[model samples]
Target: MNVGEWAGLVAAAGSILGGGGWFVSRATRDAARATAAATEAAARANAAPAQQQASLAVLEATVKRVDEENGSLRGKMSRLEAVLRAFAWTTDRWSQQMHRAGIEPEPPHPLVEEYNRTGV
Candidate 1:
């Protein structure tokens, strides 16, 4: 070929190779970015169940603690109720003995007065 034709052919080859290289580089970069994004998504998906279980464990422990505290409080309340009932029974027995002995118990206690007033 003549020098001019050879030069034109080289220019055409250079243009083709440059365009091909650019296309390949862009495609490879895009593929790498897509792979990175997919890997991050997969990691999060895999961890979700474990994270959920940890959260549930904390919730279960909290519920158990509350139940234990409530049970302790209920036991305390029951003992207090028993003590109060004993006091009331002893007071009533004393009042009955005083009345039978023909001795008036002093001024009625405030609780007795309230009971008399309300009939409760």
Candidate 2:
């Protein structure tokens, strides 16, 4: 082939190779980005269950604490009710004694009357 023709052929081959190299480089970069994204997704997937378990543990502990507090409150309420009942019994006895002595006892509070009516 003539030198000019040979040069032209070499130029054409170089252009094609350069274009192919650019495409290959671009594809490699895209593949790297895809791999990084997949790795991040896998890491998140692995962590999710652990996070959920931790949250569940916190919830369970909270519920247990609430149950314990409720039990304590119930005991306190029972004692308070017993004391209130004793007070009511004593008040009734006092009112009866006053009546027997021909003295008028002060009237019970309206709220006390309502509680007595409702038995609540």
Candidate 3:
């Protein structure tokens, strides 16, 4: 071939190589980006279980607090019930004494009226 033809051929080869290199570089960059995205997603997936466990721990702590509060309220309710029972017994004894001495008994207390109303 003539020198001009050889030069043209060399230019064509260089153009083809340049285009191929550009395509390969683009492909490599895209693959790297995809790998990085997948790695980030995996990290997030791995952290999800630990986040859930922390949430469960908070829930367990709340339940324990409520249980303790419930126990304290139950104790207060027991004491109040004992006080009411003692008051009722004293009132009944007073009424019996008044009836034996021919005096009319006093009216029922508000709490006694409520208890009688509800039968609770």
TM-scores for all predictions: 0.57, 0.78, 0.63
Task: Compose the digit string of candidate 3's lDDT tens values, residues 1-120.
Answer: 999999999999999999999999999999999999999999999999999999999999999999999999999999998887787778788889999999997798787888757744
Among the numbered candidates, top TM-score falls to 2
What's the C-alpha lDDT at position 58 in model 1? 100
Candidates by lDDT, descending order: 2, 3, 1
Could you tell me how far off, in angstroms, the CA of residue 47 lies in candidate 1 after the best superposition?
1.7
Clashes of 3: 0
TM-score of structure candidate 3: 0.63
Query: Which one is best on lDDT?
Result: 2
Q: Which of candidates 1 and 3 is the stronger one according to lDDT?
A: 3
Positional deviation of residue 117's Cα in model 2 after best superposition, in angstroms: 1.1
Q: How does model 2 score by TM-score?
A: 0.78
Per-prediction CA RMSD (Å): 4.9, 2.4, 3.9
Q: Could you give candidate 2's per-residue lDDT for residues 1-114 as a string of tens digits? A: 999999999999999999999999999999999999999999999999999999999999999999999999999999999998888878889899999999998889998787
Clashing residue pairs in candidate 1 (N, C-alpha, C atoms within 3 angstroms): none
Put down candidate 1 lDDT per residue, 4-118, tens digits, no spaces. Answer: 9999999999999999999999999999999999999999999999999999999999999999999999999999878766777787799899999999988878986775477
Candidate 3: deviation at residue 108, Å?
Answer: 1.4
